[model samples]
Target: MNTQPTHRPVALCALIFAFLITTAAADKPTNVVLILSDDQAWTDYGFMGHPDIKTPHLDQLARESAVFRRGYVPTALCRPSLVTLLTGHYASTHGVTGNDPSPKYAPRDSEVYNQRRAKLISYLDRFETVPEALGKLGYLSHQSGKLWEGSYQNCGFTHGMTRGFPEKGGRHGDDGLKIGREGMQPINEFLDLVKEEDKPFFIWYAPFLPHTPHNPPQRLMDKYSSPDRPITVAKYYAMCDWFDETCGQLLGMIDDKGMRDNTLVVYVTDNGWIQDPKKNGYAPRSKQTPYEGGIRTPIMYRLPGKIKPTERTELVSSIDIVPTILAAAGASIPRDLPGLNLMPNLTSGDPIERDTIYGESFAHDIADVDDPEASLLFRWAIQGNYKLLLTYDGEVNRYQSTHPRTEKRPQLFDLIADPTEQTNIAAEHPDIVKRLANKINAWYPVKKRKVLTTFQ
Candidate 1:
């Protein structure tokens, strides 16, 4: 036999090694980054066709994403909406229908309030959260900002900044709120650790930006402020710009780490906000109401070479987020989840099978921790071009003083014609109203529902 090895065997061995490396890379789990904008209107973004507000990074994201302009959360409040995103369950199903427990039950700073809050947080134990589900797949998750439901550990986050509720300065985010406002150090550190360990990561980056305190940098304020634009409006717009800058920083960091190709980024707003022209607060029909400005947001998912970028006008919900994420991760989706897996729609360009999406709006304060209907204010359904909002009898709560339900009737709008929801065509289209009302009832079957106006 010849001493020299055959060239054919050497070539075969090289090909085998290459094949193994490709397979391993393909099998690597994708990193997920959930970016939640707090209290941003659907129409405020540059990509969404706002006249003045500039969100360059988000516009870029929208271009790279499967943007759904008609996305709506089940509830139009921060806590419940965030809970829905985490669990893929509606506010009613998750039993966290409000931001806080009823103040009537206990004073805000009293031990009783803390106890009630603890009880409210306990509701999360009933369902599997996005982080909890991903944890089983060896994903290291970090909770950075706007976490209301107790600690990051309680929510299955491996590392996080929230100290949990009842802790000092722990109502919403606590120290976690510092992520975007102060700097990106916490997230940067977490990303570095993930790279070192060679493990998949999930980041919950729900910064309390563009929500309140409308205090942007002087440069941004100056850029937005004008003679016609009220100071309040200018401040709000500037806050949006600030939020976009933070998002740009985050995406840039990911790109710098060379992880953009393997990371899946999802963007959504917790709820919508319309700043008052004359005041420093949210205007009516937005934030805590069932109107479009309150409930609607531009939901986007960007995964390079995975999800095709396209604008979808069909109705989608925040409920679909968990299933979509799980499906992308090759994990088992819980059969009981009411939301649809959006992978097909996103990747294959298939239409969402369902024709209608439903939502429930509850009081700002939880009337009962166990009963979601106790705080139920409105149950709305969007079917095709028509939207039906059925008002229910419930406590308005102390917080809704600025914007209370003035019309105690079943309001129906042709969304195609009246996107602003200025006109109610319930009487004109009783048949459509009844059809949507029936659909809502079939979905929720609320026993405590006291409809202000019947469709008869």
Candidate 2:
């Protein structure tokens, strides 16, 4: 009896060891994966009540994520919109208001065009990107698809596939475009390296699927095509299905690697698209305009055991993504970011405090590389249920023939009453229009922009 160890001391030692183990687990860094859709309409997903399109994987993701049905990007174009996500700033603030520099420097073979393109890519140097900020915490980032800001290295990615602009055929994605379309080899290889190193990882998976050249697998084409639906529409629909399948594969890989619990996955689209029924191109008032069909998307955040799945109707912007990811990784957020940290909103189900959100649309080609306001087309504001779209005089550039803006006046719509924006109540609701217009101007005062109507 005297030789036996005391039971109380052994029990106390076991409790202390268990506490240390739990603390270490809690302190482990989280992995991040950002899935960006190329050109998808806000209404095209199965979870969004689409009658025909079957996005089963995205539907499952919606169920598991904190889904914001009324999410939007500040600009409706691809390059500038993607830049906004990277910098956590509006297109106005970041000085990347358009996809390409002014068409005046065009022909694609000129030295002036190359110089301007190089200048456009240089804009990323000024702002601190998500990958750059995460690197301070010993995290590794990989850039895979749809990179416009030069190479992955330029964007603070440890590993990437984009050769970057100034390289031949390196304008948008170059070799990086093959991530989802060709295969997921690059992503899998990067994941393998991350596992070997045992480090936290960040992946930018912006595939060029369903954007254009709507070529889907034969099986998917057979499923979506029908006599009632045009071949053009069917092709677009099948592309959506294919995009969803790729997403499922990516997510399934994470689950297979046993990284789902420690991964924070976010989903959004670069911009919106409405496929033409008669043609293969995008229809008017979509992709490059300030309409709901152009700017709206379903933003989602999923972190197993951390973020509770809930649908939020309050307006959220892609700008909030960077700050949210930063907060989730326990990194210090930059004070200059205009968006809110959505950690509380995601984890505790707290409603976003701000009621008013602002957006600015610009020409496809930059009128002035130094001045973001030079290419301004529309500066819109959504306050409560009323949305006000104030048009500005600017060149439509490349999209002039395909998607022209004919409205030259302030258009106001009660989104709750008429979601499709069929009727304009600007004349009837002068008070509301003036209020929203002032709010928009105050948010981003453009001295050179020519306002079609005076709010005062």
The list of candidate 2 runs beyond 4 A from truth reads 1-14, 454-456
Give a tens-digit lDDT track for model 2, residues 1-456: 599767998899999999999888788899999999999999999999999999999999999999999899889999999998888999888888888887665766588877888888888889999999999999999998898989889999999999987788888899998878898988888888998999999999999987887988899999988889999999999999989999998998899888898999999999999999998889877898889988989999999888999898789999999999999998999999999899988888878899998898999889778877778889899988899999887766677763455667789999889888999888888888888988987886778767855433
State candidate 2's TM-score: 0.96
Candidate 2 overall Cα lDDT vs. reference?
A: 0.89
lDDT of each: 0.89, 0.89
Q: How many backbone clashes does candidate 2 have?
A: 0
Tell me the lDDT of model 1 at 110: 87
Candidate 2 pairs with clashing backbones: none
Per-model TM values vs. the true structure:
0.96, 0.96
